[model samples]
Target: MRPKMEFDPLAFFTPSLKEDSVFIQDDSLSVKAHVQIAIHQSVTSERVTSWHDDSCDECEEEEDALMPLHILDLPMLRLQPPYPVLVTILKLLSPDEVLNFEPSNRQQNANPDEEAIFREKAISSIHLKNALTWLNNSCPRLNASAKLSLVPHLSLALRANFTNEYNAYMTRIVSNELSWMSEAEKEEVQSLASMRISENCGRMAQPQLKRKIHLANLEKYGREYIYLNEPSMTNDNLGLKTWGSSLILGSRLLRVSTGSPFLKEPVLELGSGTGLVGMCCCLMGMVTTLTDLPQIVPNLQTNLKLNNLENYSCAELDWSAPGSSPVYGKSFSTVVVSDPVYSSQHPHWVVNMISLFLNDDINNNSVLIEVPLRPSFENERQLLWKLMSDQFVEVESEIEDGYDDFGEMKFCYKRFIRKI
Candidate 1:
């Protein structure tokens, strides 16, 4: 028979996380310690020593405290997108049975029998209130149409006593980013305001140009990312949206056959759209700088904070204005580029930027670039290959498939070491 487990007070309870460090909390006593649970293995011993040094007697009865414990990584707490989750949540909150939000087949895949239980849980006043608060604060950079469409559903949810919160959020939206929305868009919103709330409840499709997509690298690093993307029509710069090559490049960079070069070097990523690849480098314990055009810098910065990765930084670097001086200083050991070759002129501009920013210590430094194969940029692709190969030898090359802004496109990644 297996030995019965005993309740151990010093069994390493979950320490409260404040930023990067961890702390212990009791009813009347709160102690902050430098011992990080995730990074350190001997947390209990360290905690005992730390508490003793700090003169705490809560667990002093036990001299040698030991417990079979594993400090597990915390699961990421992410906001569910407002479309389906919020829509169903709102329907559950409304007292009036005007709208019937039957679960879609995809939603039923989780557990068909627990629909009532899920609905009851969703209707909890606290959950509903918290959901609204999160939506107001952490809402993605959505376009006017998407924002306007949610008004009806939001109205139904706020029908009880939460109108003030809804009104405040709407006012802020209108006065802030939506202020410059076209006159037609304002009229469209006004028209929708009077429409039946039930009909619009099910019309929750995200527009093509302004979809919020999440890309995951959980296998490489332990986290996934959320990115707000605008199609080429909405934003002139394609860097506003994430491309498939960034994923390919990110995975390739993390799963390199050689030693983890990223861990040893200061890395710079050019054309870092949504900063997915660069952020992955940071997750792998490298100091990564994500750079793009000035317009895309703010959004990239927002993404960094959204993912709780403010340790990584962002900068503005236009390849067209490739300057003589190193933009991010002169010490970047690895330079990464994802889908940077688009137009014919891009090859020269991008290569020049790489040459300027990438370190000259050929033996120790390298350039990692992933370029998609597009028929329109065939000549430009050849030019980029020629220019990079002349100055840098291809230490590692991978011809892989990835999606571009338009969808799946074949891509090739090359790790280049400057020729001796």
Candidate 2:
């Protein structure tokens, strides 16, 4: 029989909140109810940096000389008490409950600095101590699985209050580096950790951010590919334009082709970094093969297993060599590649290799390739199109939109149908 787990709220909450007096005993409710209340309150009462103020003259003013002075856009109020303690209180407090409430008056609009301090104090004086007491006594059931999923929010709450205990907990979690766990478990932990790290360090701190190639949306949802390797593709070496465009085009193709006769078709991805596109294809019920340099295979495999995709395989393929064909066998009806045309010298070889896997009988096969419209690769893109036109007819060509932290941009996708 499985061991009977005791309720140990402190095991998870204490480490995240960094305070011993936060939980309280509760006789009135089940452990799950207490947890739900606590989480819901935390999510709902989260600090809002912006507030609505219709009474302010600035709302109605346009081109008025006093508009800037009348506006009351104060900086966000940082929580005074530890966020964990406050979250606990908000959960227990009734909707009608009021404690030390203070509204931002229009008269104080001109004094931004003074208004900021008042907002902070008002939010802090709400007294989270009682909430913490209830949580402690309730003894919620939180385990590794729950903790992993909650880490991102926990980290954010802890960092806001600058609690060393929570920081220590985060350090321990990352230090464990439990990469061997099942895909769901790994992602539960990784997603939280990645988000926390990204949040704490401003975007500029991560210079290689642009180079982090995500798998195409299709591969992500389809779960077709298992791994992505990019040894030469450092974040700094490549721009977001190339990576974003490739994923957009690849995802669009997969979205439109779902449930077609090609659903279960075997797919191969070249230069598969972070295996995003290929993984999406796998999830769509296709067998996927991801190829890149040997050094990147381990990380790629780790990501595949992290995303719960077990149907994909990975291998190394140096596109410039004539002997590289050993990695693949049997023709594929649909061959897919993204942003592979980096260097001008290799387009011909890459095109020739793509031709090898596509059936010569044009009526039954298709090839899909995505490339960016950069000045350096204009000639290479032309060469690839010319090579494909020799055997296959252009079936579809269009510019697709891609997403980024900033916004979205258009990308190019060209599909070729085999000609008889």
Candidate 3:
């Protein structure tokens, strides 16, 4: 007799377990009919089981092939755009997987100019209404410094390409909020204003052309008695080119004069344009007085402030006119001027002015003048030199390099030491 098989419900339903033979629930009286029928069914069932096993084997092979793809062993997804897409992929990646995502050259070559133009247009159109909305909506979370950055960009847009609608808006914002700003914020606003003006002008933009002309005039007249003031305050091409040479020679003379143990006297700089030479004297510990026309006094003051020197004072003194005595009247140890002989009519007048201001004490008094050796002013320079020689026993002259905007020129310095 064949061994009896127990029925298993799970094995009967499962496709994998139907491979060998069919099992009967009861041993029937007729093995020919029931048992034969079961055997026939079992034979057919085994064929179906073999087909399912083959199908499962094919499926397992396909899944195994796709496993490497799920791990992203290839570089398909990385070659994409929109930074957020890359960020998302990066977040999904492990540290080692992230190392494989190299930046694509093609993606990097995408044009940003369109984006920039759009941003500029949008920022330019940000009017008062929008700015106020932005402030109301965003400012509570931002610090004062961050809030300050918004105004300057808006100011630039207003001054550059924006319509009056924007300017009026900016003006309102500034007028209302600027006073409440900290000192640093106020400075930032001032800087923005200056930057806007500079950007619009494309150069060092002066507020007034007339003021510039007046300042230039001061430089020209003041250059006669102050050596360093020539190139600094005046825009004269000749004066700037001759400056370097004058500085070298002037420096030598300054050393000789100041080296004297008994020469503890104040220096006076006439026509002290930007006050460069006079400032040099101050640096050497000499109290120096700077003078120019009335119109240039404010500019001179500004220059002095820029240099952070406290020992110098500016006054308006026309070399042609007799004036109130200066602070060190008749007591100035040194009187200095640079490029003062540019005009023919003014040479003699400058000489007379020098004569009047020189200390009567006579022992330690000296006048130093630096003039460019331009052909046009040669006669005037000679006349002034002669006048100085006549007034002082010791008159000396030297030639030095001069600085001009175009290049360099030879300049002359005439020194007159009064005889006791």
Best by TM-score: 1
lDDT-sorted candidate list, best first: 1, 2, 3
Better candidate number, 1 or 3, judged by lDDT: 1
User: Could you list the CA RMSD of all candidates, in the order they appear?
Assistant: 21.9, 18.4, 37.5
Per-prediction TM-score, please?
0.52, 0.47, 0.43
Point out the higher-scoring one by TM-score: 1 or 2: 1
For candidate 3, lDDT tens digit of each residue in 1-420? Answer: 211223221221112222223222111111111111112211211111111123344445433221111112211222321222212222112111000011111112222243342233232323323333433443332112222222222222123223233234323333433444466745544444333333233112212211111111223233222312212223222222123333544455455545463334477777665556666666556677877655555666665665566667777776665455354254577788876655555677677777777776656688878876755456777887777777776467777764432223577776777755
Q: Please report, as a residue range, the 10-residue window in candidate 2 with the lowest summed lDDT.
A: 67-76
Q: Return whichever of 2 and 3 wins on lDDT.
A: 2
> Per-residue lDDT for 168-191 in model 2, tens only?
433444455454455564454444
lDDT of 2: 0.44
Per-residue error for 126 in candidate 2, Å, reads 23
Candidate 1 global TM-score: 0.52
User: Clashes in each model (backbone N, CA, C under 3 Å)?
Assistant: 0, 36, 18
Q: Which ranges in model 3 have alpha carbons more than 4 Å from their true place?
A: 1-250, 253-257, 261-264, 324-330
Model-by-model lDDT, in order? 0.51, 0.44, 0.42
- For candidate 1, the 10 contiguous residues with the lowest summed lDDT are 67-76
RMSD of 2: 18.4
